[model samples]
Target: MQINLKYFASVREALGGGETVSLPAGVATVGAVRAWLIARGEPWASALSEGRALRMACNQRMCEAEAPVSAGDEVAFFPPVTGG
Candidate 1:
């Protein structure tokens, strides 16, 4: 399945905004996608690292890593927001 990924804020700066990714036959979840990207090493490994505090959304709805993902779905990753 092909998925559209969107990065925001610092995540975007680190991962180069967004791009399309293809997943081989298997159950692909939000967390799985992240892990896949992190496997790319370097900036991807660090930016989407499990140690990082990042928020996610699927099809415009906030969701956890375990959220189910489907082809053509738009997944977004962004850091938690803070205001003064």
Candidate 2:
């Protein structure tokens, strides 16, 4: 299924904005999508690593790793924003 991805802030800097990706079956959750991208190795693995502290959203609403995702849904990733 194809999902639209959006990267923000530092994540955007590393990944260059966002793109659409056709993921293999069994990737039904946001975490799975991140895993799939990490499987690509290098930049992906490092940028979205399992240990990394980050934020995610689905269709513009904040969500956790367990958030369900479907074809055509938009998923976003980025480092947590901090303000003084």
Please, what is the TM-score per model?
0.94, 0.96
lDDT of 2 at 62: 96
TM-score of candidate 1 relative to the true fold: 0.94
Q: At residue 44, what lDDT does model 1 achieve? A: 88
At residue 70, candidate 2 shows an lDDT of: 91
lDDT of 1 by residue, 25-65 (tens): 66488998888889889888999999999999999999999
Predicted model with the maximum lDDT: 2
| Overall lDDT per candidate, in order of appearance | 0.91, 0.94
Instruction: Give lDDT tens digits, candidate 2, residues 1-84.
Output: 999999998888899899999999899999999999999998888889999998999999999999999999999999998999
Candidate 1, 70: how far from true, in Å? Answer: 0.4
RMSD to the hidden true structure, all candidates: 1.0, 0.7
**Model 2: CA > 4 A from native:** none
Clashing pairs in 1: none
Query: Which of the numbered candidates is closest to the native, going by highest TM-score?
Result: 2
Clashing pairs in 2: none
Q: What range of 10 consecutive residues in model 1 has the weakest lDDT sum?
A: 20-29
